[model samples]
Target: MEKVVRHRGWQWLVGVWCMLAGHMACAQARTELLHRAQENLTRVIVHDIFSPPVASRIYLYANAAAYETLVLGDSRYVSLHNQANMFPKIDQPAAASHINYELAALYAFLRTGGKLVFSEPMLKDSSEHILAGVGEVDEVIYQNSLRLGEMVSDSILAWSSRDNYAATRKKRRYAYSKEKGKWTPTPPGYIDAVEPYWSQIRPVALDSAAQFKPVPPPAFNTDAASDFMKEVKEVYDVTRKLSKEEILIASFWDCNPFYLNTQGHLNFATKKLSPGGHWMSIAGQATQRAGKSWIETSKVYLLTSIALFDGFISCWDEKYRSQMIRPETVINAYMDEKWRPLLQTPPFPEYTSGHSVISTAAALVLERELGEGFVFDDRTEMPYGLPMRRFASFTAAAEEAAISRLYGGIHYRSAIVNGQKQGRGIGNQVIQKIRLNAGIGK
Candidate 1:
């Protein structure tokens, strides 16, 4: 009887040990939870019609909140408080708290994102849906995890509040100058320039907004043989006789947030993912392919968002400084009175393509994270009805993105080329600046 009792007791102890081991693995295995929360944030950003620049801001803060939570809760990861210098020191939970870092990271992302968007109730509904799907958990661990999440998100929110976004809102709107070759609102919607003062916002890693400034745009001359006119003619000619392949490529890369469709006086607005949102989705997809743990995935999003956050600041500085005109506006006025490009031009200056700049920056950072020559199928456009496109490498995808701006007729070749140069510099700078996940980016 004593031997039989000892055998049963040993079995019970082994069972409990297995359950504990599984619980720890579950913490790392449920990275999908974080991705789902990020997807929800993207949905809200689309619903809100956030411009690309503003969408980039929302992405960085939400992702930073999640990333910072992991750094605080997980000892495997190093804290970026002093490394990045953007995040301030945050209070942590008690040392022995049985916290679930995965749940906490999701909550941090949701809470920070909810504060940035207008529709809190929508985010609230998604939050409940996400939380309901989590696996069974002890009530004590659940409460402790959520408390830590709030503490981390609150610290991120405090740091973001002083980036000068509010002060720019109080400033007057951008006024279009009557000078020749200056940018103005484009047709189809004729919306005013989006985020003209975005350069004034604080940068995350860059020393200043103009840290990666490109050379001045081609001289604006109307003479038929002039460099500017030659560039202008190329756009008019290429768009006029676009191939089926060109159309598909242009449509695939058109990450316009809000586009107006008009038909005989019945006009409505259509919403799509912003440029930054597309890259964020790609990172999520790639990480899943690599089977990265939650800690690795968190760092990827944080670093990619940092590149995009600073890329926009650098690009916008040159944009408003040069104030070069868009292709559609110039082609219609000088080349052909009724000439419209194959794609609708976005409402912004054309000195540096935002798509080109941010895309290259994102791709460079992704290469550093995922590595060079990493091939993957890009399904980011599938949600918008486009087919999957395969890439041999991150650089290949980035080059395609830069050329897409020209094919879309939204950018001069100079803008796309220079934007790539600028983006490359920003990407290298970001990789050099961030310290966590060492021996990886280097």
Candidate 2:
């Protein structure tokens, strides 16, 4: 009888140990829950073929929603509302409430992102799968966490409604100008200019959309000896004479989500990440490489997304303002009518390259958060079929992204150089203005 009693006691201990171990494993995987949610958002953005500028807006709101949720009930983190404008005060968890903050973060992210994009079903399916896994473990915690998530998501969605996005949607299409310097549609799709009133949308960090506008692009000049013409000639010559490495560099960074391919009588679009999406991938890689905690990871994403958002606003404000002509239009009309750029020219005005401004802004934020001299191999394009590329540092990667525009035959040299300056300026602004609470994030 004593031996049987001892055997029963050992069995109970083993059962309890297994249960505790399982809970721990789920807890650890929750960090990855954030990454999975991020990946889902990235995929949806790509599939939906959002223009680069619009994609930046989507990233900003989603991650901002996530970070705000993360800060709730955790004194280690701080809400952006405390640092920047446009945020409403979010109520903390009730004193007796039981909530899993990370799950709440994912919920807010998916909910906000779904509201912004057209393909809600795609994102909704993924969200359900993630939540179902939590449900199996502990129905009570899952219910509580989701309730917290919904509350946080509701506040953010409400804030987003007032950002003038819908008002911009009702605005007229971009009207073209016959003047030589002004922008017009490109070949293939010739889609209307994307988000022309994006400047009018409320900024998350900037005082206004024009806060860090670049200097006006060089005046329209075609004389061979003119500075403006020289930059145009440089783009023409470099793209036509691109070496294998240069071609690779251009192709690697060709994050044009609007790229259209044509066959005999048939044209199809090849959807890919925008330049800002690629930077988001890099931010994720850096966090994983350094083994950052879930909270730390959310902070990195939130700041980087903010930089991308403001950079686009600053870049686009100049793009439409200068209304500079694209290289393809110039080279084909004057230099070679039969010539086609190595990459498709996006449908928008050219001046301050969007790639340069956003890349530099994102890199600067990452550099400050990840520290200088941080190294990582970018596999962001791998899913799009490009091999991974290594970078010695964040700024180095940003420089390459800026120059890729010239090699891709999309922007003039001045656009690339000045865009870098513009982006760096925006980055400095974001890094200075938006900071972690108590300086816990490093």
**Top lDDT hit:** 1
Q: Pairing residues by index, what is the TM-score of model 1?
A: 0.93
TM-score of each: 0.93, 0.92
Candidate 2 structure, TM-score to reference: 0.92
* Residue 209 lDDT, candidate 1, scale 0-100: 94
Question: Alpha-carbon error at 389 in model 1, in Å?
Answer: 0.8
Question: lDDT tens string, model 2, 1-442?
Answer: 0001121343344435547778544454456667778889989999998888788888888888888888885787788766677789888878325776777788888988998898989999898655443333245666676778778888888887898888988888678888876888888777788777778878777888888877878889888888888998888888779999889899999998878888978989889889999999999989988878777888999999999988888888888888888888888787888888888998888898999999999999999989989999999988878889999999999999989999999999889889999888889988878877666542
The C-alpha local distance difference test score for the whole of candidate 2 amounts to: 0.82
For model 2, state the Cα shift of residue 358 in Å: 0.3
